[model samples]
Target: MTLSVKAVAARLEIGRIDWSAYRAPASGGPGLRDLFLGLLDANDESEAVGCSLEYRLEVQSMVYEVALPAVGVILAAYAEDLPLWVEMEFLNVLHNIITGEPHRSELELGNFDLVDRCIERARDGIWVMYSRLSKWNSDFLLDVLEVVDSDRERFAVFKAGFYPE
Candidate 1:
């Protein structure tokens, strides 16, 4: 479902809710999902950052903390580092394609492949992390607790998932 930024803002105001309240059991489930998807899509399009108010409400309800580091890592892993690495690899590929010379170091080729794999995995990891974050939508305090408790686990999962496959 395509959600306009204005539509999201309207929903937020209509509910008389803070982003944290979207996690309340009283909140309807579909509403939360739609908001999450909308926010994700916006982020994907570079139209917005992290989560929208609607998304924040859903996440806050779920007891998750929407923090910078977590968001930064995901953005960097996919939008920045992956693309940079891909560009570098593309240059190498172009050189090879033009020169008709085999790359001397298998390590270089392997590294390029590894970086490509890392980008794919990082994309997947971000999706999983977002899914987990979206699961709750009522108890802001609880979500914060859960995020804190799972901090290391979440970071480790991201690292392992994003590492070259």
Candidate 2:
């Protein structure tokens, strides 16, 4: 079974989303764009007052986390080869949410450069951290790489290997 938006919604127990309300037609909300831009620019500042202000703002604006049941299901289903593009999209969405930007906002347009960088970092980290686990337990990392390379389609259904036939 492939993970669909409807399936994700059901899993999250969220009522039907108003698609129209979520629609981003372009050239909307400057505040959100500015916020995202600022978030992207934010660096580790040691100034006590500035840091305190930024922290307060972040506490009020940041999303902290997002519920991604669909992404989780797809990853588990295609553990043999995790789709990089899909995973990147999921990460981008999470990043946007964390920055206090609306997931479906027009201002939250896809940032391919940032997405690529994040994917590369994630791949490197996974290899470094899981290499021993892969060697001892199974070829999980290899399977993930294979799945990511094989799946080219966006938002496709991924059936778990253990799913009933």
The ten-residue window of minimal lDDT in model 2 covers: 48-57
The alpha-carbon lDDT assigned to residue 74 of candidate 1 equals 33
Model 1 poorest ten-residue lDDT run:
61-70
For candidate 2, lDDT tens digit of each residue in 1-165? Answer: 443433242222222222224223232222322322232223322221221112221233332112222223222322333234333333344333233432332225553233233233334334332322223223333334433333433212222321225
Give the poorly placed runs of model 2, Cα more than 4 Å off: 1-15, 23-82, 101-165
**Deviation in Å, model 1, residue 32 alpha carbon:** 0.9
Model 1, C-alpha of 165: deviation from truth (Å): 35
lDDT string, candidate 1, 2-83, tens digits: 4444334333333433334322223333344344334434424355343333322123222122211122223332232222
What TM-score would candidate 1 get against the native?
0.20
Note the Cα lDDT for every prediction shown. Answer: 0.31, 0.29
How much is 87 displaced in model 1, in angstroms? Answer: 24
CA shift of 84, model 2, Å: 2.0
